[model samples]
Target: MFPLLRVFLSDLRRHPVGTLLPGVALAVGLACVVSSVLVGGAYDTAIQRNKPHTPAGSAVVIRAPGTDLPASLVTEVQQLTGVATAQPRQVTSGQVLGADGRPLNTPASIRVEPSDPRLSTTTILQGRLPRGDQEVAIDEVDAQRKHPLGSSVLIADYRTGKPVKALIVGVSAQDLGRPGGIAMVAAPAFATAHLDSTTIYGMDVVLTAGTPVDAMLPRIEATVGGNYQVETAAQARASEQPSPIGISSTLFVMFSLLAMATAVLVAGAAFRAVTASRVRRTALLRALGASRPPLVVVTVLEAVVIGVVAAGLAVGSGWFISVGMLSVLNSVGVSALLGSTGVTPAVPGLVLATVAVALGVAAAVTAALRPAIQASGVPPVAALSAVPDAPVERGAGVARLVLGAGIVLLAGLLAMLGIAARSFFPLLASAVFTMIGLFGVLGPLVVPLLVRVPGWIAGLVARFLGPAGAVIRVAAREPSRTPRRAAAVAMPLAGAFSLLAFGVVGSASLRDAVVRHSDAANTAAFDTATLLGWGLLGLSVLAAVSGVVATTAVSITERRRELALSRALGVTRTGVGLQVVAEAMLLSVVTAVTGSLIGYLYGVAIVSMLNLPTAVGPPLPLLASLAAVTVLAVLAAAGPAIRGALLTPTNALADN
Candidate 1:
């Protein structure tokens, strides 16, 4: 077993291309998990920093929308046992006026409060905190050069958008998050000056030393009752739960897991093809008295080696990739929730890396399973005779078809139940399961039918390549000759197109819904999700393309004898290249069209079933992704085509 394992490693070393392709796929699979964890953690930190309620280490913050918390409530909270100090502020957004009575060039927030050193989040660099109704404090960043201290400015009412005159009594340090001015004023002065002001949105509180916030939270909540929204430092740290990312956390995780699962299926398909190509060698070993268990062990061990090595590499790759991803998020103006203070990986990163390793190994094992079982089960005599597996029975094909239909029916039943029950969870679950089945089992089935159109196109292709056209035409005509193999390569391509379509089209639907019903911030946040979905979709496609390439490359490799014979009979290299191109085009095009239809439908189904007030159409991304897949597929086949073309007839026939 040891010697066999060593030989397997040696073979991997000898054929670095095959080993590296799958290894890279494993690395990519793990990288998704690692990078998402890194970004998710970083974003968690950023959220707490950006929207900090207790910057002064406060235990609780209470705010009410459309209503002001009377000074009496603050007094009550201050009197509680754990409560050290509770400070209330009137929160509103509006423009400030310059001394000349014209509105200041910038907008500002009104946090009307009297001087309180303990609970105030701001630091007065110069002058003093607002002591009068006419006095105000503004952030230095928003002041830039305007509204200098001693300069009178109007604090506009958020509702009326009217500015009231106030002096810039103090200048606080700039809060990067609140780029607009922050006007701090005396509460008495603010109430007298602004008649329409009512909302007291926040309380900044700090606890006594060694106070436990979590334990005291319930008491705070019970004290505050239904009238106020409450938050603490602990809650802020875990704030993502209420944010867009938190709301969509399940979707994000589902997508990532789907990628991991795709990796497994792809790895399985690639390994299956590789093993199938090695059937003769394995048969000879069996004939020479090699035991079945050892052969299976050797095969599984090879996958394990590949997984461990790839996962190790992926940890590093994911960190760097996460940094890059963070930079992208920053560029896109999502710094509030997605921003990280630094790129350094943290403790959670190690956990993510460990999970990546586990996933990589699991994927490899999953991919190796069926091949191992089949290879071990093969009779030594039949294997030595080089006989194919008994032809798939008509009934078996029918059963598989039925099974595929039943899965879809089950998914539909689940979806209908969700619609009737008015529960989105069931529908969401259906989508995940449906997608898994589509990519895993149904895609290949869908694919064989899609490729049938190419025979007509082959005639047009023949005029350009002459003899090569016939080879391509034959591939189109007999695509199902190796249905299982074709399906292996087709599934991922289909899945890729499907995901791409879902992202692009669904985003369109969400965009419409947002424009009609949601705030600009909501729209912006949804855009972030769309961008993330596209980003992940791109990586999945890249990984999927590799799987397709690996499978197709194996197909080409196994047909070296046939290609070599064609060459002997005077088929030119150009014709072989044409054949390879045709094969890849078939795989790419079929999956693209089929997956696009599926994805577009899925996207539409989601919006419709979710009862969102929007419509989805086949957006340009559907076509764009299809075109891109077609192009990438052609490029993926280029290397194999060149390699196949360069093979010498005698050597190819005599080799494997």
Candidate 2:
């Protein structure tokens, strides 16, 4: 054990970068997972903390039209036992007048500020709450945009269209039920501005603590009449804050899983390269009587070490990333729109660290398993030879072809079902199956053909340029020679871009629907979508960079002999460097185009299925992401390419 440990330590010291290369992707995956959990939890906590409550305690909501609930019923409900207080809810809405004494173009709503402090859903972010008939408060988002604290603002009566002057007293976090800018005024002030302020839409009934809400519901329902609705506090809150928490949570979980899956693919590709590079060394160990089990153990130990290091780094980085995400959301008014002054980021604890490390180790071992097994099974003599890997056997190729075709057929069936039913679920299933069949199962066969588009373009450009163009043309064709590696690199990029394009198109479709019906823009939903889109883009870019780095590093290791021969044939080092960058750029372009097309079509299908108005236009963010990914891929490959190009031809050939 001691001897093996010493050897392992020595190996790590000798090839630290090579041993640790695969863990970079693992670190990114873990970091994203951590950030997602922390941010999601923090937002949830904020929502719960700032939820509307009442002085009377646990509450039940009773809602009915003003005509159904007369003044007599309201008095009777308040007089009932176990009830502390009953507050009538009304919109009392009016248009917001701008500094020019005209109503603002943006639609607005006004509600009477809760007289009871416990019932206030909003936090006063600046100054004091609205006080009397002369003062009002606006959402913090609105205050920042136009009405500053202490500024004079006007509220135009909804019925008479007469403007009432009021002083802005505070900037409050927007209510969760409200989608846009809103004004909060005292009941007296609301009555002064609007004649129909007394119109009641609902009533908040605060019950005594320890009173069974369920038991009271039957009696309350009877009292409110059959047509009226009655609900507990939890139910009412859920109804009020529909979609934001649900949407955000779902997105966070989906992206976290996607990132983890991408990391697994990246790590698998990396491990394949690592084990292949160590073939001769493995043969030497086998010759020295080391068993296959021992060899696999050694690889597992290395993975364990890498996992530990990656997890620690990921946890730390994730903390900063989660905080940054909240800061971005706050800057864009998402938090304010959701009725939060600001959400404090949830700190990752010991349990979270343990879970993260456990997941990292598990993922690392899973990715390394097949490659380690293959490396161990290689005959000593076969491994010692400087020969290329064997091609897929005829039987295996036939099986893969049959299986891939079957999966593709399944995807088609799903698409047909989706069309027949006019449902999004079946279409989504079809897309997922299509990706799995094409990329996961039939990658070798499809990738070569897919890459030819970029290769042909490079060839056209090469005809015009000189030696540099020749390098690029050669690089473009290199991916065809190693289709498996090319596919591995392309798969993650494709998935990332697919999500990006879908988010862009879907957000646009949703915004269009909101505008068409409401005659007002859904700014809050739009901004929230923007936040999630940017988050997805960041993760995608990280995936791209890490994928390119891992694949290019392995390529450099595998092609030392080939590159040395090229140098001997008078290819300049600068030309070799250009080839690496060109290869990365080409793969990125192919993936971007393929994934964007699929995602756009899927988005359209979803919009159509939902019966939304079609307003799908060019997605600016998607285009920008495509450009950014290509540039980052180039940057990721440049360092390794330059280092590989620096290897003297004599040194490379002589070592091999």
Candidate 3:
């Protein structure tokens, strides 16, 4: 066992490239999954914590649509049997000026009276409550801003746009329900804020001790004459339960599954390649009197060592990424409840152990099966010459082609029907199915189509550069030999870029349309242009970064061996690395150009279909984003290319 372990370590050191690629892939996939889970969980926990808590045995009342809950309705509910107190509440949204001179729109809640004064539970951090009209208290979160103590702020009433100025008199210790509480104003001050009418959104009531909430609920409803709904504190909390967490959880699970599946395929392919490349070495060991059982143990041990190390790194990296993402979310005011964004190390450890064990068993079994069969069937003499047979003519390709065509046809029909019906779901379904069909049936057919632009560029460069350009030409000529691997690297990047393209073009178009509509509606009182420009710049940077990272990773992995060989052939290691990096940069540039063009066309078409204002102009931001992504791709590729070049010439030649 010790000897086998020794041999396994030796093998890993010799074949670091093969060992490291899958590890990197696993780490990235795990990081994405873990980050999604942590952020989602934090959001869920925060929302749950902030939900308004009703007093023990308390109930809430809200008037049905045609009007706001009348303050009279609260009096009516208070008069009911077993009802202790009914408090009317109004909630509305208005823009308030922050200290930075930016208008921040926030929700505001007003109560006819403050939460029961006798209870003295609600913490008030600053000045006394409003004593007269025009005075109001702000939440601690908002009060920290320098809205002077006596300075008045204007808020538009919900019912009407009439602006009313309320003097900031005090600040509450805590928000009404959460970190950013509903800004509270006296009812009269609220009324003065241009509210169309004196109507309540809802009412909260406390029941007499020992009064059955179930019994009192119907009576309260009857008192309000079926024109209102009643709810207890427990019920209200339940209603506010974090719905986004469930949605984010489901999405994360789906993405994790997809990513894991991709990892498995990548890992399996890498294992097979490594194993096949080492068949003669294994045969030579058997020729030197290594027994079957020892050989099997050696193979399994090698896989375990690689899997464990990879899994550990993946788990640690994932946790770090999740924390960083959480910090960003916190900064953006997305998850105020999350104090920190990190998965417990224990959870990551357990996940890593599970994934490592799974991959180890898979690699061990996959690596051992064929070698075992060959060893059993033939002596070392015959094994030396043994070669895996070429793929059989199973008509798999034909069947895939047929299935793909059918799916494409179906997708086309669905798309046509969707356009006619103007239904969103149908259009979405059509696009998804079309992608599936293109990926399955037409992927091979389309690869040549997609590669043509790159091929031409490589050819033009090769013509000028002679032998130096052969690397580019070689990659273009035999792309099909590694189509699956190429797709593995390219698809994720393409998807991310496509998403970015859609976001940029769609947002730009939408913002333009909004500005046009706002101009017609409000005569340009709102500066939609200013908002749109800032938003586009921010979103473009985000999309470019993700695209660049994905593209760079794929390019480096796919060309590692070729880059190693170039170094072995007496080419300067730096020169070879630069070539590899250059290849990636070129591909990324092409992808960006194509993606932007497609995005623009698709964006314009959708906008037109939706009857939006169409504006056709050069996409300067898109161009800038593409250039930035290309630079990022080069930077990301450089590390792997240098690693590839560092392989000793002896080892590089030995592999071939």
TM-score per candidate, in order?
A: 0.76, 0.84, 0.68
Task: State each model's CA lDDT, in order.
Answer: 0.66, 0.74, 0.53
lDDT leader: 2
What is the Cα-based lDDT of residue 391 in candidate 3? 15
Across residues 471-571, which tens digit of lDDT does each residue of candidate 1 receive? 76766743465566567667766777777777766688778878789767668778776666677676667667666677667777677777888789887
Q: Candidate 3: lDDT over CA atoms?
A: 0.53
How far off is residue 140 in model 2, in Å? 1.9
474 Cα displacement, candidate 1 (Å): 3.6
The top-ranked prediction according to TM-score is 2
The residue-by-residue lDDT of candidate 3 on 413-481, one tens digit each, is 877776788665565566557656754355555443565566667678777877656666554543355
C-alpha root-mean-square deviation, candidate 2: 4.6
List model 2 lDDT by residue over 1-656, tens digit each. 44555666887999788788889888988898888878777777666544443323438887774343555667878887877767666555567787677877765555565644566544666887676777777766667666788897887766878887888887765655544456454544556555354556677788777778888888788887787878887787666563544545666767787888888888887887778777777786777777898888888888888888889988999899999988888777677656665676778999889999999999899888888898888677755576443322212278888998999999999988997899889999998888878877787777667767756676788767766666656876777766776777778878788777777778888777666666434655675767666675667557555877887887787778778888898888987888888887778777778888888888788778888766666688788888888888889889888987897888877755
Q: Give the range where candidate 1 is weakest over 10 consecutive residues by summed lDDT.
A: 387-396
Error (Å) of candidate 1 at residue 575 is 2.3
Query: What residue pairs are clashing in model 2?
Result: none
